[model samples]
Target: MTTRTAEMLMAVVMGLFSVFLMWKSAELEIGWIPDEGPGGGAWPFWLSAIMLLCCVVTLFRWWRRATPESRSTVQFMDKNTRRINYITVGSLVALLVLTHIIGIYFSIFLFLLFYIRFVGRHSWLLTGILSVASPVFLFFFFEAMLKILLPKGYSEPLFYPLYQIIY
Candidate 1:
């Protein structure tokens, strides 16, 4: 399909999804409560509402061919780009599946290692720094500061020392 057609189709799908989100969120009370700062659904409902508006505007622009995105008939991707896209998407899926086995931090580290070292052809030093540092930063940000625990899977014990130090 042409880019314009694909854009319209995606916009329509997103618009429908936004509407569904808004409807579901409204069931939990979309407005603010007198005592509470905001109802459980307030944030989601408002965000979905905004998305719906953007989708509507996109649809209108496409209909009018007002923007280059709306007017373009370009093919989305060539074979090489498509192959690269598929590889990237496959790696991300692998990362997600690995998360269930090795845990989020380790999965993220592996992903960064693969992307930076192999796909990006970066220097080993840079790849090593990013792959190690990102997970550590994430651990500190989520576990130490926010008190949020990410999935640790079979590697839960590995974080005990870090947790002991932080706590």
Candidate 2:
């Protein structure tokens, strides 16, 4: 499909999804609770409501051909670019699956190595530095300071020392 048609179709789907989210969130009470600050569903409900509005505006723009995206009739990507896109998307899916097995931080490190070294054609030094540093930074930022733990899978034991120090 042409870019314009594809964009319009995706917008319609997003609009429907937003409507569904708003509907489901309403079941948990979306308004303020007087004593409580905001209801459990307030964030989701309001965020979905805003998303639905934006989708509606996007649909209107698409219908009127008011935006450049709506006016474009070009094919989305050439064959080589499409191949690269497919590979990138497939690798991300693989990474998600791998996360379940190897843990999030390890999977992220591997993904960074793959993306930076192979796909990005960057220097090994830069790739190695990033692959190691990013996950460590995330571990400190989330697991240590924020007190939010990410999945560790079977590699949880490896992180015990770091955790002991941080905690």
lDDT (10s digit) by residue, model 1, range 32-116: 7998788999999999999999999999999999878778888867688888898899999999999999999999999999999
TM-score versus the correct structure, for each prediction: 0.60, 0.60
Full-model lDDT, candidate 1: 0.93
lDDT of each: 0.93, 0.93
Query: Model 2 over residues 24-89: C-alpha lDDT tens digits?
Result: 999997889998889999999999999999999999999999989899999867788898998799
